[model samples]
Target chain A: MGELLLMKGNEAIGEAAIRAGCQAYFAYPITPQNELGEYLARRMPEESRVFLQAESEVAAINMVYGAAGAGARAMTSSSSPGISLKQEGISYIAAAELPCVIVNMVRGGPGLGSIQPAQSDYFQATKGGGHGDYRLIVFGPSTIQELVDLTGLAFELADKYRNPVMILGDGALGQMMEPVEFPAMDEVTLPLKPWATTGMKGRPQNVINSLHLDPEDLDRHNAHLQEKYRAIARQEVRYELENQDADYFLVAYGTTARVARNAMHKAQGEGHRVGLIRPVTLWPFPDAAFAKVLDRARAFLTVEMSAGQMVEDVRLAVNGRAPVHFYGRTGGVIPSQQEIYEALIKIIQGGEKA
Target chain B: MTILVGAFGSGKTEIALNLALRMAAEGNVSLVDLDVVTPYFRSRDQKEALARHGVRVITPEPRVAQADLPSIPSGMEKVLGSEEGKVIIDVGGDTMGARVLGSLRRLLPRRHSLLFVVNPFRPFTATVEKTVTELRRIEDTVHLRVTGLIANSNLGPRTTWETLLTGHEKVLAAGRQLKLPVIFGTYPCFLNGNGVRSNLDLPLMPLQLFMFPP
Candidate 1:
């Protein structure tokens, strides 16, 4: 540990990116995530790094594209509505294989939703919010420590695969304060980007573009991208299993997982067999981990801050081997521990539909 | 007994909620939510939980809780004037938030302590100079000087023992420059059994989460 500090999730992401050797940050102010840009705005000048309060989310993400194309560790952060505006740029970044980090401190949303925390952007993040069939490597961290750790990992993964990675969080995580130890600056080592467009002084010029007019060329490019995605899915499916011996399990991610853990413990205290499976990576879905639980758990309840997004992935993983049920609080409503515990008990007793 | 004031996202509401719960264990305690700046994460949001623990909460009426304009409840003066027990005022973030306190300054007891909760993690109070600037602005707006400083530095869930100490040092330095006493330090209660421990001799306020989970 380099130094311990009590930091908000938003501020921690900013500090983690800086310590991870991120050289450029561009973002427009939005609720629950404005602190990130504000933090970098104050620190970047002191560190002699690039920090810009872009005119809009669209411009900010495009700036990320420009910086990533120039071979610099770059990032942009926003909440749900702001993220919607950047989808076009995100697709372009993904198509061009520009390494960058984008943080979505999600709030309730369909249109201009409440500024309170919600996981309603599950599909947008995991299924690709932009046009075309691109996927963002999404990491859903339950704790602030995980947020810090995963933020660093997101940058490295973005660089490693030359693909954009996202750190998904909600208003609760972003605004809440927690104790964190940032990695020592010397501890982080980044791979050299040989394909970076650094003026091409003594080598062939590197052209970075997402527009390939030829259908055959586009097909081949997408095939290569799909291969990379498959490799990532095979290698980076992270999840946490608690009380695996229990007959009933709850599936959740991000802040919902924190509450689910509490609910699981409560159910256990009552002599009921209940466990939790928390997916750390939302995109990879952790289907294999869910499969391991299928044999042991009689039923799985998917709890989320959204209506029922990740539950679809859970159902696909369970595949009728076990009953898959969903319980959610949408539009900025967070479910309570007691509520989840009761729901699990209802499911276990066969009183509720699964 | 105390008035907690600080910059936005300084964790004052969390500290206030915890302090109210602690005080309620000993005597009748009332928590006043004077935050009119941010609609979310206000102390009033935990009214039911606090009331269950015998802590009286005075906040804006339900019909106007989310209103953008600052509307101090009429019941607030009665609670502030009561001679029965301890009272905690959780002022909103920044000098603008502190402006609400100006109207209630006359009702505050002379012996009450005005604590400036310093969370170095917040961008506005990240440095000693910036912290001092915020403190002065709050003092100016509320027309009351902060009697002491409380280092409540934290990074939401990423806070560690070192985070508190690092913030403590900067807060202590700021207090010395401002000729104010460093009163106490705070750490989240969740870290109690964790390997990290606070070495600061100052009194510790083990903050509890009052905000709803995301």
Candidate 2:
């Protein structure tokens, strides 16, 4: 029974960051997500918190790196191409094991694509857009409420693993309004970063850097990062399963998950046994959610706002146990519920190749 | 003609859409989607539903409708010129959104009502000062004074009678300071008869729009 308020997904992220005690927020303006920065711009000053609109996305992420390394809860947000600009900085932060939250309100893109919502950044997020021997924990929430909840959780997990965490959203979720109950500010407790590069006062000096020029040193760092990722994969896999015992399962995440759930209900109304497996955390991929219904799964159909992105992960998770199919609308177009339902019907009829 | 403009997420599109539906009963109505600041949740997305209600939906060209460009649709002058019907312009949120109205100022009907829709729950309009400031900014950007205030404040699905009442009080205070009339407060249609419809002192409009994707 926290105070509930109507909020756009972008604005919710800003409030969540502030409530999470994010000491610094840096970002450049981009459509679909501009409201987020705008929200923070006004609120941060009121809170006496650091909110800087950096000159570019690259500068913004690097600023986040500085703030995070100094032991402040830091974050930045951007759409697709801007996110691409932040890749190298993200990689540096990942290697340095800095705790920070990055929000990607994804827009359609190979370049400066349309400002319309799209989940085409699947590979860019979960698979490491930046050059790396590292993985960032990425959460794709379907609703503004979930986006708020995950924004709080993202800061916690980022600190828990001392790793960068990303909230992967899109223009639809960013721009749409929904009722959200944010966590009470007093309930938030930030973890202390002993490894932070805070100036030492007679304590051991600390230095934070990403470069490991020595091959052996880099190998050891990579192994440690891998171990942390394994632990995350073990404990951080999050998803929602509905009608798990149904014949056909729809695998989707973010806004596409909502559309798929509607299609699932539509198919159910027609006496078709369709289910949904919505991955909240895209990187971990929620393989166990697939396992929950694999026994009853006739097949798994992956839906996305891109041509086919998360479908590859769904295929990997199903691992040939069930035929994994994909249906998507790319270039900023949202796949309608009817389109998804029709795709499911085709798959059920064995008319479409898996 | 009545035009709705306000802070982002202050329920402009919702109120505008609902207002258009209500006005359609009286005569022909046209809901113009003037939002070019954001990429989703514009009123034009409900063109099919509004059309069914006999309210004509005006938006950018069909091909560029999905594109987030500042280009205004061509037939607005004809629609705005018509005195046989009502036109409700669902302007985008904030001063940035209000900029689109600048180019259309010449086409605006002389008797048009510019209403500043306010939801005090939104961060930008959370305070009386902030709400008045944002409304004035919109006025400056569009070069049109807001004639009245529409207190359509709610926390979406989680809106409670308490939420609506408190938001209404803020909007009322803002209206008093601006010397503008508080036209009415809006409650979601689902909350109709749950007490807010009859209990609130101000005239209340029932909103049936949630703008969800199918």
Candidate 3:
């Protein structure tokens, strides 16, 4: 085991990126997620890594694209509004098949809503925020430890798939402190990037462009991307099932999943057969993990800090086999354990007749 | 019972919250959120949770709690003057934030301790010279000499035993330069049985994660 340090989720992600052999970090300051850029600003100079506070979120993400295109492990972080500005650059990176990490320390927003944490970006993340047919392997970690572990994993996944990866979190996660042990720097092994546009010293020139002028060639590229997505879905579906034998199940991800865990234990203390299904990988959806509890669960309650984003995925996973209910608190409000427990009991009781 | 002052992002709020929770076990504890610099990550954000543990939190009135502007409630003097329980003031980040303490300095107990929390990983305080500069600025702004220093060197999740020791060394250097006592050094409790132990003779504050899980 490595050394344990108390860390906010944002700082954890920053350090994990460094340990994972990231060479460059580019970001524009935004509330909630600024700690990450600040952390890197101090450490990157010491480590002799590239750290740039870009002119804007757009410039920051484009800098990430430029760095990743040249085969350096690169990352950028932002909140909701800043993230929106990066979508065009993100699309270019995705289309170019560049490997990089983008962290969204999400804040509440349809516009500039609130600076507090919210999971409303679920659709923007998993369903592709940028234009064109593309996908980002999204990881939603509920614990600070997972934040560290998954950040390292996100880097490796991006490299292995030659695709962009997003670590989706919120203000609560970004700001909250927890104890985390980072993997040793020497222990992390990065894969070879043969396609990197480093130099053409003795080989043919490598072109790193997302633009495909031919319609048939674009269709083929899209088809290849879809194939890669299918392979990722089959290989990277990650979720955790707690008290799988219970009659009631709560489905959640990220910070909301942590809250639901506490609520599940409380409901169990009340003699209610309640369990939790926490999705660690939001993009792959982890639909098959629901199958383990499907036979015994009377109903599924989808809880979130958003209106009803992941609930749609849960319903599709259940596929009319059982009832799916949703409870959410938006605009940066986090629901309490008592509220989630009560909602579960109400669903279990009312669900018997339905 | 204590006043924690430091540069922004130095983990003072977390330390104050932990100290308040610890002190609450002994007697009634009141936490005053004097942080007016940053809108988020204030002790006031955890008011309800702290209240559940019997820690009285004196924050701005409900009408202005959400506002970005500084609005110190008038009740601050009353709470600072109360004789019933220990009081912890979580001053905002930097000398600018410490300036708020100038107005309430006269009300503070004569023997109260003002702890300068030093996290070497933070940009402004990374060097011994920079840390001393910030310390002097806070002391000047608050009109109170720092009685002690608390070493809180960490790199968030990427922190190692070496990280803490490196920070402690910087604090020790700063302490020698400033002629202040290095009162305590902190390490995350997760390292309790991890074969890494502090070599410093100073008291160790084993920090706990008080924030809600991410």
Candidate 4:
């Protein structure tokens, strides 16, 4: 909300979590994401911070589950595989309906893959990584500012929706330096967490488990979460970009969206009407933004670091009203300006009115 | 057999492709293009050429090879476990490129070698310490060990012995710090020896991938 300072995307998430009144952070170090843990490790202790580098990704997420069950703004983070390890704990956090933040600075892979910046984790984050029919509000921040601001917003929404929120990052943003303004200390007085485990001094034995034995009881729990998700779909949606006037929309998310922004300007410079639509929140996707574009554009290109994971969502948004094109650079490879330009050129030539 | 690493314009593709050809000539070897970090010029780009030489090239199908899919080929462990003579994996540049292999490290054989190809003219090329750190980071992510160093310094088609020597000296120093052995410096050439005319320490590796890219 103020002047920005130069910062990495991962560090921005770390600072934003603190400002959002997050009481604790538990994390495990991995490439492209070690900086995030390092940032929190440095800052959390200065203000009597509650930060711990749990032995593994599983342990770190479980710790967040513990903290959030106590009704605290808690967080944990890892890259792709580490996030995979965090699946079980996340499901519990989601089921318990606690407010918590999860930061995933994604790298290439389904397994112990490369440490390059990749958006391959889209489905895992948006569709829910854990088991038993659950969903988390996943936010895709394309810049250092969003990385910071998104964390604060994530805490707010997790409480508002009674769900888990994740700031999905990649190595490029995690490692890259940029200008960002740190939030003022006074502005970060977090709302009281009624579910927090503050020593159980004033209440009965406080429990934070996700075990519901009775079929009817679990069914009610599932139904309540479904209603909450429906509410979130209607209420919490965010997107950004400056190409509403253009005939073609370039849709991208996370760091790939930053590349798309550059591609948009480049296309404009080359006498093409290319605009970009960047979804800030992956889950509760900015469907309305694309819905507006469906009537205006001939086709929408979903640019990502992986193939067409979000393309399906674009199709739903357009609902076959406008064609959806998929253009992506996979693994940790960031597509160059030329590559994106080529995709635009193809779309212009192929999707044009003959 | 060998993996190449360097910045853009560095002759990694050439060296890796040529090494695969040589290894394949010796036996039924496969050259897998792990160059998921670079979208074009991949060692697997010359799959037809490898096919011509009785070498198998594995490129993931277009669907799974999407922009955001993890490029680790499923069941890669089985393939590496069956390596008879050589299997060359041409990795892409820096930590970004090397990391693709890191995820598949658990699948890599312990006897396999990882080559950190160096070009002295590239940015951040002044020190071996930088090389060591990058290799360490790559090793950490993939959990694989770096076995050797490749001093592959060349200025496009006009490369020479002098440039190769300079690149070699820098790499040797860096290798010393990294505690890695110099596998070899590459020599790119065409008919009449008109390409990469370089003479350096260790065995000279003739590269063939410079000319092939999609």
Among all candidates shown, the one with the greatest TM-score: 2
- Which candidate gets the maximum DockQ versus the true structure? 2
After TM-score superposition, the amount by which residue B132's alpha carbon in candidate 2 deviates from its true location, in angstroms, is: 3.5
List the candidates' TM-scores in order: 0.83, 0.91, 0.81, 0.62
Model 4, B30-139: lDDT tens digits are 77766665433456547777788887876666565433333765555667777576777777655666677766677677777677677664423535766666667766
What docking grade does candidate 1 earn?
Answer: acceptable
Point out where model 4 deviates above 4 Å: A1-4, A199-206, A351-354, B1-214
- Each candidate's interface RMSD: 3.8, 2.1, 4.7, 12.6
Candidate 2 global TM-score: 0.91
Question: How much of the true A–B contact set does each candidate keep?
Answer: 0.47, 0.70, 0.28, 0.00
Give the per-residue Cα lDDT of candidate 2 at B169.
86
Q: Residue A18 in candidate 2 has what lDDT?
A: 89
Measure candidate 2: CA RMSD.
2.9
Q: On TM-score, who's better, 1 or 3?
A: 1
Model 2 over residues A45-81: C-alpha lDDT tens digits? 9999999999999999999999999999999999999
C-alpha positional error of residue A212 in candidate 3 after TM-score superposition, expressed in Å:
1.6
lDDT of 4 by residue, A1-354 (tens): 653333546667777787787779998877767656766886798768798988888888888887777777788888899899899989998898888888888888767667677899999999888898888999898767668778888888888777899888887777654556667766865676666667867688756768999999999989998999999988888888577878988988887877788888888998998888989889988888976666678778888888669888888888888778888877778877688878888888884431
Tens digits of lDDT, candidate 1, B6-52: 98778888889988999999989999999876657788888999999
